[model samples]
Target: MLISSSYATSPIQTYKQSETKPQNVVDEAPTSQGDTVILSKPALDLAAKEKGREFSNSFVMQVANQSNQKAEEMLAAFTYGLNNPLIDISSLNPATGNGATYTRTGQPVTDASEVLFASQNESLLKRNEILIAQEREKGTSAATILEKVMQSIDQQPQSYKDKIDWSRLSS
Candidate 1:
C-alpha cells in the first residue's frame, strides 16, 4: 500500500473588511516589480475635462518624456500632421545661465543681447537649433503630440496594489 499528499500553491487570498470601517473595502493584492499601471480612456477624458487642456498637455508630456519623434508618431495616430513649422531658438546668456526659449511656428529673433548670448555659448545654441529643426521635420505639433500621449495613457489600467503577508500579522 502507498500514501500520497498534495499541497496548494499560489492561491488567491481574500480579506474581510474591518468592523470599525465597514464602509471602506481594502484590497491588498500582490503586484510584481515589473507591473505597470495604465489609465483608461474614460479616466483620461475625465481628467482632461476636469483639469483643462493645458494641465492635461503638460501632464502627458511629463509622463511620456520630451521626445519630439515620439510625439509625432502619437499625433499621426490621430490623423494630425505638422507642416514645415518654424521654431525660434533664442540665445542664452552664459554669465547668468539663462535665455533658452524655443517657440514653434515663429520667426527667429536676434537682438544685441541675444547676439552676445549666442556668442557666449555657440555650441549649445547650435545643438538647440538642430534639435528643434529635427522635431519640426517629424511633422507634428507639440500640442498634438501631447494629445496622443494622453489618449494612449487612457488605454492602460491605472491601479497598483501590493499584497500583505497575512502570516506575519499578529492575531
Candidate 2:
C-alpha cells in the first residue's frame, strides 16, 4: 500500500473573462420589435423636418417670453417717468455704456423715459396689427376697427397720451 496526496482545486470565477468577451459590456435588453428599424431617405428627411419644426416652435416661445418681460419693463419705466425727471449725459459722457440705471432721481436726457416712449409706440403698433387681424377675422368693418382703436386710446391716462409719440399711430 502507498500513501496518496490530496490537493484542493481552485475555485471557478463567477464573473466573465475580459479576454474572451468585450471589455465594454453593453446591455442586451429585449426590444418589442428588433434593435433597429430601416427607413427610406424620404422618411429620414421627414423625421428631420419634424424635429426642426419642434425646435422652431420652442424658439418662437422663447422669443415671446422675452418680449413679455420687455413689455413689463416698458410699463414700469413709463409709470416712473411720469412723475420723475429724466436726463441724458451722452454729451458729457460720450464713452458711457448703453443701458439705463434707475435711482432716486431720473435722468435729464435720453433715459428710461425715452425707452418707455419708444417701446410703447412699437407695442401699440403691434397691438393695432393684431386687433385689425382679429376684427377682420370676425368680419368687422375697417371704420368699426378704427373706432374701436380710438376708444381704447381714449381710455388711457391723459399723461400717457401726452408723452407717447402719436405720429407713428397713423401708419
Candidate 3:
C-alpha cells in the first residue's frame, strides 16, 4: 500500500467548533550542526592516487622531511599541493553517509593550551598592587596606634590606679 504523506491530512478539525474527530499530525523538524564542506571529485581522484601510491625510498624521505618541518610550514605546503588531505570534508551528506563531512567540536590550536587559557593573573596583580599602595598610604603604623592607646590610658590616671571594681563587675 502506497499511502502518501501529503494526502494524509486534509480537513482541520476543532474541538470547540466541530463534532468530528481532529486529525492529529506531527511535523518533522530538520536538525543541524551547521558545518561547511567541499565536494571536489578531482580531490577524491587525487586521494585515490595517494592511497595507491608506490612508496619508494624517496617518497619516505620526502614525508619524513615534511614531518620534521614545523607544522605550519608543512600545512602551508600541503594546502598548496593537490593531495593536501585525504579526508573529503567537501563531500558529506548526513542523509547518505558517503563522504568524510563530520563535525569536530573544537578549534585545534597549535599553541600550548596554557597560553590559550585566559587567566585572572592581571586582575590579581592589579589587586596586589592596590593592596600594597593602600598599605603604603596608611602612614599610621601599628606601633603608633599602640602608642596613642597607651597615651590615652595615661591621660586617665584611674585606669592605671589598681581599682578592679569587683562589685560593679559582679552586679
Candidate 4:
C-alpha cells in the first residue's frame, strides 16, 4: 500500500527592503563656511526688464478697457501729473490776494474762451480717432500703441535743459 502524505507548505515569505535616501537630494542651506551664490549683473538687468515689461502690459490693458473719454482723462492726468483738477475755492482767502473771486457779470468773458474750448475739444477728438484707426490698422490694442509711444518719450532726454533748448528753438 502506497501512502501519500501532504504537509502544509511554509507560508510565502515576504521581506520589505530597507528605505534608502534618494541620491539626488540636495542641501540648499548656506554652508557654515559662508559660501553663497550672487546674481550676476546681466541676470539682474534681465529681471528688471521683465518686471518693467509686465508693468507696461498691465498698464496697457487698463488703458485699453477705458472709453475714449476715460482715455483722454488718463492722458491729461499723466501729462499734468494731477489726478483731479478743481478750483478748490475753499482754499481761496480773498483778503490774502492769493486767489481771485469771480463775479458773474451780464457780459461773458470774451467769446474767445468758447472758441478756444471748442477747438481744443475738436483737436482731442480728432487725435483719439486717429489713434483708434491706427490701433485697428496694426491689429493691436490701444494700450500697446500707447506703451510704445511712452517708451519713445522715455528714451528722449527730457531734462529742463532740453526743454529750455526746445523753447528757444521754437521761439
Q: Which of the numbered candidates is closest to the native, going by highest TM-score?
A: 2
Clashing pairs in 4: none
Ranking by lDDT: 2, 4, 1, 3
lDDT (Cα, tens digit) per residue for candidate 2, span 99-130:
33222122232455556656665666566667
TM-score of candidate 3 against the unseen true structure: 0.16
Residues 1-171, candidate 3: write the lDDT tens digits. 011121112111010111122223346867566644665999989988766343223222233234434322322221222111112234445475444411121122112321322122233234434543454478644232222322222233231111111111101
Candidate 3: residue 116 Cα off by (Å):
6.2
RMSD of each: 26.3, 31.1, 38.1, 32.8
Please, what is the whole-model Cα lDDT of each candidate in the order they appear? 0.34, 0.39, 0.28, 0.35
Off by over 4 Å in 4: 1-69, 72-133, 158-171
- The stretch of ten residues in a row with the least summed lDDT in candidate 3 is 162-171
Error of 1 at 156 (Å): 0.7
Please write out the lDDT profile of model 1 over residues 84-131, one tens digit for every residue: 111222454547544433231122223543454334334433444454
Reference-based lDDT, residue 111, model 1: 56
Clashes of 3: 2
Across residues 14-50, which tens digit of lDDT does each residue of candidate 4 receive?
1111122212325586586557678999999998976
Local lDDT at 25 for model 4? 26
Model 1 pairs in collision: 38-156, 38-157, 39-156, 40-154, 41-154, 82-139
